[model samples]
Target: MSDNVLNQLRNKRNRPTVEPRQDALVPKVQPEPQTEEQNSPQETSPVPATDNPTATPADTIAELQAELEKYPETRRHSAIVLEKDLDQELTRFCKDRGITVEVFLEAAWTFANADNALLEKITTEAKRRYDQRKRVGQIKRLITMLSNSAK
Candidate 1:
């Protein structure tokens, strides 16, 4: 086996075990019950009144437009880091169709969100990949243990 393959196996064997979240396992604290005195109504400050009592529909639209201006239209980019071969395959896939990887991902997202069957198919594919990876990990662990014992 190559040095790289041996290094990878060693890294997996020495990987740290993740502990379960203590906060998640702990029970949530319950709020104390309010007594009659605590629940009793008390004098409170008056709430602020709307700035415009008789705002027109056009004014409301203008206000919404102004609010939207605060959050200017911007394109957000996300990335997925794939292994070397997978990365090359995805790049080739997009290149064959004369589209960028980002465009391909966006189109796939839109199609999956719109079509239930496509979404289900993608989910199944993901599950299958996860199961395959899990099995591979188990085999790697077994190989690591066997190698260590032989040493």
Candidate 2:
């Protein structure tokens, strides 16, 4: 893009500039207490096409939220607090990177939900490290004893 176009784009919005915030706007993990019914996936039937622009606040909160909860019985819905500047930056970043936040979130959810045997892996690693330390201590003692005898 030409400098003139870039300048125009930048000046197109006369909104007051917000100070850069330090904290990245990310989705906060809010684990809700799960009930039995909430463990099932809600079967959201396909909604037919409509000529409504989803970009605006014209859609009711309840209506938009309803679109989020598909299998409410299987999983819980999380409410997010979005900081406006952070949200805009994140959106631009995603667009620039050609990344789908939903896909990444889904993959993350799948990994988190899977039985990854994390505890077992941690335990095995701890034991291995402990054994290595013990061996190193023994080797140090052996070297000290041999060196003293040689001296």
Candidate 3:
């Protein structure tokens, strides 16, 4: 082998591999500042509170009644039944807690709406018991069959 050829081979083997530059791999992010005018209440027209401080309970009830009239009478009757039961439950719970029915109802609504795990657990337990009963029935049938075969 020629000296030049051997040197060339050695140089090729020893030379470090060049990789492609990756400056573009990292993105440049610039956060723009929010303007004072954009943050101002005037820029976003202050939403006039539709909450009427002066509206009496009677007025609120009348408005609700009007809204309820839009639905069928059967729906209203069902809603009344649900409301009465809710009220009764609230009253009972409130008496136990030494609090007012209204306060207890508000708390109970919050609690019931927050998590449905209790409901799910109850249903699951009921289903498990039903399945167990079915299994017991199958075993009883098997025993009955064995006894008949022996006779």
Query: Best candidate per TM-score, number?
Result: 1
Please give, for residues 1-151, the per-residue lDDT of candidate 1 as tens digits.
Answer: 6999999998989978898763322233446678877977756535432356455556656866887999848587666756689889999999999998887887889889999998999999989988888898899999999999999
Higher-ranked by TM-score: 1 or 2: 1
TM-score, cand. 3: 0.25
Per residue, candidate 3 scores C-alpha lDDT tens digits across 56-89 of 5566577668879997563222222224576688
| Model 3 weakest lDDT span, ten residues long | 74-83
Clash totals in order:
0, 10, 0
**Candidate 3: global Cα-lDDT?**
0.64
What C-alpha lDDT, on a 0 to 100 scale, does residue 84 get in candidate 2? Answer: 71
Clashing pairs in 2: 38-73, 39-73, 39-74, 40-73, 40-74, 41-71, 41-74, 42-70, 42-71, 42-72
**On residues 19-133, what C-alpha lDDT tens digit does candidate 2 reach at each position?**
9863222222345778987998756535433334332334444555777776444454575434478678767877887885554556655775565686467568769968887
Error of 2 at 4 (Å): 82
Displacement of residue 39 (Cα, Å) in model 1 is 80
Worst 10 residues of 1 by lDDT: 21-30
